[model samples]
Target: MKIEIWSDVMCPFCYIGKRNFEAALAKFPDRDDIEVEWKSFRLDPAMPEVPRYQENMYQFVAARKGISYDQSVAMHEQVARMAENAGLDYQFDKMLVTNSLKAHRIIQMAKTKGLGEKAEERLFYAYFTEGKNLSDDAVLTELGISIGLTATEVKEALTNPVFQHQVEADGAEASRLGAKGVPFFVIDRKYAIAGAQPGTEILKVLQTAYAEWKKDNPGLIHVRQGNTCAPGNDCTN
Candidate 1:
């Protein structure tokens, strides 16, 4: 089974959706054979590249939304609590409200080299956990190196904009799929689940996909499915 997920690091639900999808994958009978890809989505195309201070950003965005700063904090608090349940901590305090187009370009490059997932993991954890600047070449290089990519390869990948067209192509594809949000998951390029659904919901989708795959590959042994899981347990559909 091939699962392609479109998500943005800045979106809190993307992290939760990742955990949900992982849970589903853990339960698949053919877990070892499953292929997963993370696609980039920019929630705010016009966003800046610098880090955003919590207080100021909260006030600025909330005022534009006609809500108080406290309301924004409350919303962030809700997402933070959800993240905790998912075994992840989002330091929104350290987040930079920046444009993600360049980040998407890097991901498109990583995909060609079969290092897309590693690069994405690094980018997400760095942004939501360590408060790193995504626009920094040094940080992006470190991310690439952490994924076993050579330093020169990483630098060349970022500097040359080789994947610029690829990123745009992905955006165009997303548009064709009617994707309007991050954390949109497409299974076998047939089924799509939008937003961060719960673990059970994701697992069911995986199970459905597995059934479809079995019809095409008759002899493929499916992974043993377990009892339906809640949030924490792995999903094997």
Candidate 2:
């Protein structure tokens, strides 16, 4: 089975959805046969590259949604609790709000090195848990290096526009698929599950897809369709 996931590193639910999907995969009997491709989807593509240290997540959310700061804080608190249920510690106070284009590019590069999933996980953990700035080239380079990518390769991928097209293509594809949010999952190009669905729901979808995939690709089958004649009787009889 092939699973393509469109997600943004800055999305708290994306991280939570990742955990839920992984939990589902762990119980899948054909886990090893599954091929997962991580697609880039930026929540705030127009966000500035440089973050204002004076501004915090709550303030940013409040301004963007026209909600009160306290309301934003409460909302974040609820999201934090959801993340906690998925075993993630979200430090909203320290979380920085910035563009994730460069981060997506890095992930696109990691896909070539067979480390796309690792790169995505590292980026999410860095942003939500460690409060690392995704916009910083140095911080991104360090993250790349930590995931077995050389510093030189990381810097080159970030500074150059090599993987930019791939990242854009993923986003375009997401848009074409009618996706208006992050953490969207498509299985076998047939079934799609949007948002951070529960593990049981995700697992059920996986099983359903796998079953249908098996039905489509049932492998080779042998058939015996020969006619037998009596030993002592003539073929005409």
Per TM-score, the best of the predicted structures is: 2
lDDT of 2 at 67: 95
Count of clashes in candidate 2: 0
RMSD of candidate 2 to true structure, Å:
9.5
TM-score of each prediction: 0.85, 0.90
Return the number of clashes found in candidate 1. 8
Residue-wise C-alpha lDDT for candidate 2, range 40-84, written one tens digit per residue: 998877778865532499988888889999999999999999999
| Displacement of the residue 85 alpha carbon in candidate 1, Å | 0.8
TM-score of 1: 0.85
Off by over 4 Å in 1: 51-57, 219-237
Q: Pick the candidate with the highest lDDT.
A: 2
Error of 1 at 233 (Å): 46
| Alpha carbon lDDT of each predicted model | 0.77, 0.90
Candidate 1, residue 76: Cα displacement in angstroms equals 0.1
